[model samples]
Structure formats: C-alpha cells, structure tokens
Target chain A: MAAARARSEERRAAIVRAALEVIAERGYRGASLGAVAERVGLTQQGLLHYFPTKEALLIAVLEERDQWDTGGGAREGWRLDLLGSLVEYNAMRPGIVQTFSALLGESVTEDHPAREFFTRRYAQVRAEMAAVLRAEYGDRLPGGLTPEQAAPLVAAVMDGLQYQWLLDPDAVDMPAAFRDFLRLLGAR
Target chain B: MAAARARSEERRAAIVRAALEVIAERGYRGASLGAVAERVGLTQQGLLHYFPTKEALLIAVLEERDQWDTGGGAREGWRLDLLGSLVEYNAMRPGIVQTFSALLGESVTEDHPAREFFTRRYAQVRAEMAAVLRAEYGDRLPGGLTPEQAAPLVAAVMDGLQYQWLLDPDAVDMPAAFRDFLRLLGAR
Candidate 1:
C-alpha cells in the first residue's frame, strides 16, 4: 500500500511538471488539461483524478515552482545579497521564469484564479523584505525611508527586472541590475 | 464624401474602444471578436471592415492607448519628472493600465501576437530611457553608472512598480515609489 501511494505521488508530480511545460508554451488561459495529460501519456480522466480540477493543478504547479525557488518555505530575514543570488539563479531557467511571469501578469485581472494567491504572496513578500531590511539597517534605511517603505521597492525591482530581462536577455543583466538597486539602498 | 469618411473613422475608433474593454475584462486569450462587436453594437462582419483580423484590432487598441499616453507623439528628451507625472497619470486610469499590463505579461509567451510589438517597443523605450538619463546626467551619473547602464533600471522600475501597484494598490503608492527610485538615481 505504501508503494502504491508513492507511485501515485510520483504521477501527481509528473502532471505538475507537464502542466508547467504546457503553461510555459501557452499562457495560463491557453493551457489546457488535455495537453498536459497527453504530454504525460495520461487520459484527461486520469489527470482529473489526480488534480480534481484545472485550477487545482495550477495551484500545485505554482506551489511546486515556489518550493524550488524558496526551498519549500520562506526564509525569514532574507538579506539583499541572497536575493541577488536568486535573481542570478533565475536567469539560468528561462522556461520556469517565463511561466511564472506570465501567470503573474495574468493574475492582475479581476477574476483570474491566481489573483488571490499572488495578492497574498506579495503581502507576505513585502513583510519578509521589511524584516530583512530591519535586520540589516534597523529603523530607517540609508535613503531615509523606513524598512516598510523600502520593502516594496525591493519587491518591485525583483519583479520588474524579470520582465525586462525576459523581454531582452542580452540587454538587461538581471543580477547586475539587482545589485545596482542594492547599492541604491546603501547595502554592501 | 467627407462626412462618410468621418463616420467610418468614428466606427473604427468605437471598435477599438470596445476591444479594450473586452481585453481588460477577459484577457486577450479569453476575449473574442464577437464579444467586442456586441459591446459596440456592430456585427462581427461589420467590425472586420474596420479591423481585418483580431490581431489587427489588438494592435489598434494598443496603438490607441499609446497615443493617449504619449499625447499623439513621443516626447523629445523627456525628463525624469515627466516620467513621474506619467506614472501618476497612469494611476488615474485603471482600465487602460490593466489592459496594457495584461498584454505586456502575455507578450512573454513565445508565439503571443503581442510579442513582436512589445520586443520592439522595449528596444525603443530603453533607448529613450538611455537618452533621458544622458540628457539629465550626462556620461556618468552620481551612481557611477553610465546612462546606458542606468536606462534598463529606469525602465524596470517603471514596469516593476506597475506590477506591485496592480497587485495591491493600497499598500503601494506607485507615484511615490517612483519618486523614491528617482532619488536613488540622484535625479533632482
């Protein structure tokens, strides 16, 4: 029974992987369960049995991707230099980054399934950034803005660099630009 | 004959307006010509007279929005303060900004119809930003980076702030955040 359950988990992981690939090629609106099923040599019914719904599968894919990036949880008091490393790491994985960016852009619409997820995620991220800033710089940053004020700028640069780098990789060096932002914050 | 031509032009503008509404609500992939035509009280066949294809209509809507933002022409040597004004102005029109953001996000997908438009647009925008930075700061800015090095960061902040603002408007003061970025650049 344990072996059977393990097999099921493996199948579920494969479905999420295929879904990411499909979403990378087609935007979330264009990605369909049948394409994901076919990619994994499973029927639509088989995919549904594991995910129950397309939205569920999308959530799983998002969670899985985040796990890969965050190591299954948020890092408390993550420093600016660590974020610079993550940005550099992201540059090596264009497909995953593209999929994540596309979903992020789509989530801004009123009814997108991922809307709440991204909205909540940013709130948490801003908080985490604030903690990091406070840990490093105390009450106020070198720019005279409080940690709360600087948090959004940190989040914005991370996301904004992804958009520009994805659009033109050669032109926008994501990590270097991020380091520049760090310098602006007076971080060493 | 002049009156007939003017009426035709009005019809084209109406179609573009309807298209923006549909795209904003349903995203580009989910939107259909039928829905846009229905919104403007025109049959799909009639709409085709104004825009031969959906892609053409999409392009028209984007161009129209650009016209509105650019004031029907590009600014020559636009200053940093002017960009701050543009960001502030964008906050006032949520619908237009949402549609543009949705399309910009979707354009990252390889075969998306807006891909080429965005790619070319960014190339132009980055050059314009470099020009603006050079005009304002000359060869080396206070941050010790060249205008060319700084242009992408400027573009990134403008777009990055949009994503953060779109996600959580109450938490992010988009214009003020932009002002913070300008301060980082040491722009007066």
Candidate 2:
C-alpha cells in the first residue's frame, strides 16, 4: 500500500509539471487537459483521476509554481536580498514566468477561475513583504513611510519588471532592473 | 467631400469604442470583429472597411486609450501630478483598463498579434517617462539616478498597480498607491 501511494504521488507531480509546460506554450485559455495529458503520456481520463477538473489542474499548477519560487521553505523569514535572488532565479526559466504572467493578466477579469487565488496570494505576499521590511529596517523604511506602506509598492516593482521583461527580453534585463530596484530600497 | 470624410472618421471612432467593449467583455482571444460590429450597429464587413483587420482595430483601441490618458498632447512635458490624475481617471473606467491589461498580458507570448505593438509602445513610454523625469528634476531624481536609468522602473510601477488593483479592488487603492510612487520620484 505504501509503494502504491508513492507511485500515485509521483504521477501526480508529473502531470502538474506537464500542465505548466502547456500553460506556458498555449496560455491558460489555450491550454487543455488533453494536451497536458498527452505531454505526460497519460490518457485524459487518467489525468482526471488526479486533478478531477481543469480548474483543479490549474490550481495545482499554480501551487506547484509557488513551491518552486519559495523553495517550499520558510518565505516568512526571507529578507530583501533573498527576494532579489528570487527575481534572478525567475529569469532563468522563461517558460514558467510566461505561464505566471499570462494567468496573472487573465485573473483580473471579474469571473476568472483563478481570480480569488491570485487576489488572496497577493494580499499574503504584500503582508509578507511588509514583514520583511519591518525586520530589516524596523517600522519605517528609508523614505519615512511605514513598512506596510512600502510593501505593495515593492510587490508592484517585482511584478512590473516581469511584464516588461517578458514583452521585450533583450531590451529589459529582468535581473539587472531588479537589482536597480534593490538600490532604490537602500538594500544594496 | 469634407463632410463625407468627417462622417467616416466618426464611424471609425465608434467602432474603436465598441471594440474596447468587446475586448473587455470577451478578452483578446475571445473578442471577435462580428461582436464589435454588432455592438456598433454595423456588419463585420462594414467594420472591416474602417479597420481593415482585427489587429488594426486593436491598434486603434490602444492608440485611442493613449490619447485619453495623455490628452493627445506631449507626454514628455507632463509632470508627476498629471500622471497621478491619469491613474485616477483609469480607476473610473474598469472595463477599458481591463481590456488594456488583458491585451498587455497576452502580448508577451511568442506569436501574439499585439506583441510588436506592445514592445514598441513600452519602449516609447519608457523614453517619455525618462524625459518627464528629466524635465522635472534635471540631471538626477530623488534616488540619485539619472532619469534614463529610472524610466523603465517608473513605467513598471504604473502597469504593475493595474494588475494588482484589477485582482483586488478593495485591498488596493490604485490611485493612492500611484501617489506613493510619485512620492518615490520626489515629486511631492
């Protein structure tokens, strides 16, 4: 029984990885379970046994991406420099970044399936950024604003850089621009 | 003859407005010329006479949006306060903003029709932002960086805020956040 469960978990992980590839290549609206299942050498029915629905599959893909980004480690304790490193890491994987950017853009609509997920995630991200700032520079940052006030602005810079970089990779150096932002934060 | 030209120009403007509505409602991939024509009380063939193609319609919509944001005037001469007002104005029109954001996101893909348009637009926007900063602050801005170096970052903040605000309007006060960014520019 233990061996069977391990095998099932491994297969599920494979499906999620394949789903990310499809999403990157075809975008969320274009990505289909049939394509993802084909990529993983599974029949559509077999994939459904794990994800149940397309929405379930998308949620898994998004959750899995977060895990890769945070290293499945303690994100709460990370400081600004660690966040900079995360930006550099994202540049190395354009496919993953493209999938994320596309979904993020689509989720803004009133009725997108991933709308609540992104909204809640961003709130959590901003709160965590505020905590990171407070830990590094106390309640107030360099600009005389409280950490809470600076947090969303920080989040915006990170996401904004991703959009610009994805649109014009050669013109916008994602990692370098992020480093410049770090200088703005007075962290460098 | 002049009256005929004026009437044709009015029809073109109406079609662009209807196209923005279709894009906001159905997204770029889902939006169709037929739907836009229906909204504007024309057949698709009549709409095509004005736009030539759906891509042309999209370009017209984007250009019109720019005209609204900048008053069809010199963006390089605008100050931070004016940019803040544009953000406030955008907040009042969520559908138009949504259409722009959705298209911006999709344009990042490898073969998206709007890819070249967005890439070129950002290049122009960043240059204009740099000029705006330089005109307001001379050689350097608050953060001790040249306007040229800081332009992309400024553009990123504006676009980034739109994504976050669209996802969660209650949590994100978009105009207030933009004002904070203006403060970063030392405009206040």
Candidate 3:
C-alpha cells in the first residue's frame, strides 16, 4: 500500500510539472487539461486521477510554486533567505516567474483556488518572516515598525524586482537593490 | 467634419474605458469586444470602427491607461512626477492597477501585442526616468549604476510593487516604499 501511495504521489507530481509547463507556455485559460496530459504522456482521465477538478489543480500548482520558490532552502533569516531565493529563482526559471505573475492576475476572483492559496501562503510567509524579524530585531522594529508593515514590503519588493527583471534582466542587480531596501528600512 | 471626428474620438474613448472595466472584472479572454460594445452602448461594428481588432482595442486601452496613470500632466521629469502619481493612480481606479498586474502575469510571450506594448512602454519610461536620474545626480552614475541599470530597476520595482498591492493594498505603503527606493538610489 505504501508503494502504491508513493507511486500515486509521483504521478501527481509529474502531472503538476506538466501543468506548469503548459500554463507557462499558454496562459491559464489557454492551457487545457488535455494539453497538459499530452505533455505528460497521460490521458485526461489519468490526469484526473490526481486532481479531480481544475480548481484543485490550480491550488496544487500554487502550492508547488510556493514550495519551489522557498524549496526548504532557507539557510538563514527569512528576509535574506527569501530575497536570495528570489534572485536564484529568477535565474533558474524566468518562465515560472511569468506564470506566477499571470496566475496572480487571473486569480483575483474571491473563490478562485489561487486566491485562497495566495492569501494563505502570504499569511504564513508573513508570519514566518515576521517571527524571524522578532528573533533578530525584536526590540528595534524599524522605528517601531511592526512586522506586519515590514513583511509586506519584503514580499512586495521581491515581487516587484521580478517584474523589473522580466523586462530587462541584465540591467537590474536584484541583490544589490535588496540590500538597498534593507538599508532604507534600517534608516527608518 | 471636426464635429464627427470629435464624436468618433469619444466613442473610442468610451470603448476603451469600458474595456478596462470589463477586463478588470474578467480576464482578457473573458472581456469580449461584444461586451465592451455593450458597456459603451455601441453596436459591435460601431466599436470596431474605432478599433478594428481586439488587439488594437487592447492597445488603445493600454494607451489610455498610460495617459490616466501619468495624467499626461506635463511634468518636468517623468520619474519624479510618476513616482508620486502612483499614489494618485492607486486611488483613481484600483481596477486599472489590478489589470496591469494581471497583464504582466499574462506576458509570457515577448512577441504578443501586449508584450510589445509593455516593452515599448517600459523602454519609453526607462529612457525618460533615466533622464530624471541623470538630472538628479551628477553626470557620474550612482553606485556604478548606469542609466541602463537604473532604468530597469525603476520599472521592475514599480511592477513588482503593483503585484504586492494587488494582492494586498495594505501590504506595502506605496509612497513610503518609493521613498525607500530613492534613498537606496541616493536619488533623493
């Protein structure tokens, strides 16, 4: 039974990979399940074996993205780690970044799978990073700036930098810009 | 003849405004020309008289957005005026910001009309903003940064910040973040 479950998990992961590829190539509405299945050498029914609905699959894709972005590779405090990961991420899969941005745009509907996924994801990341801020700079919260305030800027700058990179990757020294952000926060 | 021309322009503007509204509520594919026509109280063909293709219409919408965002208000330097305009824009119609972010996510192809539009827009903004940077600092670039680097970062930061704002408007203090960016740039 364990072997069967492991196999199922692998299949789901494979399907999810294919979905990302398709979504990246074609925007959300542009990519269909059949195309995704074709990319994965599976039938539509087989794809459904993992994600019973499109919404479920959208959630999976977002969850997968969150994992891939962070990837359990936090070597230090959440801020630097997150920024470092973003720099690495932009270099690794520019396509995924575009896909992410596109998903965000399309996922604004209140009940869209991505809406809930992103809301939850941000809540968690904000809290986690905020905790790290507390641990490191609990007494000095940037002129008593709450973690709530700092968390959003950290996430926002990372996202904003990616958009800038997409337009002209060579021009933007993302890490340096991030350091500048830190300096400004410290100044405040 | 001028009367007719003025009326025609109004129709076009009306259509573009309607398009922005619908596209904001619904994704691009969801916002059909028919729906835009309906919103503007024009027949589909009447709308097409101004924009023969959906792509043309979208481009018009983007141009309208550019005007509205910048206010085409005749500023001495676009960079300074526009940075301040971000606040006005967020307040003007939150939907436009959302749609712009949505479009960025959808910008997977460098060749898509929207992509081309964004590229041109970015280039124009970069050049103008870079000129602002040059004027703010001496002829010598700051931090070994060229106009090329500064231009891209400026665009990227704004784009990135928009995504964050769309996700949670309260996530980042837009103006304060811009100030942080400037301090980092030492542009202030």
Which candidate achieves the best lDDT against the true structure? 2
In TM-score terms, which candidate is top?
A: 2
Candidate 1 recovers a fraction of native contacts equal to 0.51
What is the lDDT of every predicted structure here? 0.80, 0.82, 0.66
Candidate 3 chain B: minimum summed lDDT over ten consecutive residues — where?
B73-82
Give me candidate 2's TM-score against the actual structure.
0.88
User: Could you tell me which 10 consecutive residues in candidate 3 chain A have the lowest summed lDDT?
Assistant: A73-82
Candidate 3: tens digits of C-alpha lDDT, residues B1-188: 99999988877777888998898777556678899999988899888888887877877887887776656743224555557567545645656666566666655445555676766676677777778877766554544455545665666666665655555666556666655555456532
Best by DockQ: 2
Model 1, B1-188: lDDT tens per residue?
99999999998998898888887676655557899999999888988888887767877888898777667866445787898999999887666677677778888877778877877877788888888888888997776677877777777778878877888899889999888778768732
Ranking by TM-score: 2, 1, 3
Task: Write the number of the candidate with greater DockQ, choosing between 1 and 2.
Answer: 2
Cα miss at B162, model 1 (Å)?
A: 2.1
- Which of candidates 1 and 2 is the stronger one according to TM-score? 2
lDDT of 1 at B165: 86
Cα deviation of A178, candidate 2, in Å: 1.5
Clashing pairs in 1: none
Error of 2 at A87 (Å): 1.0
lDDT by residue for model 1 over A1-188, one digit each (tens)?
A: 99999999999999999988887676566678999999999999989999877767877887898677777778564666888899898888777677678878887877788878888888888888888889988997776678887788888888877888888898788899888778778632
- Return the lDDT, model 2, position B7: 100
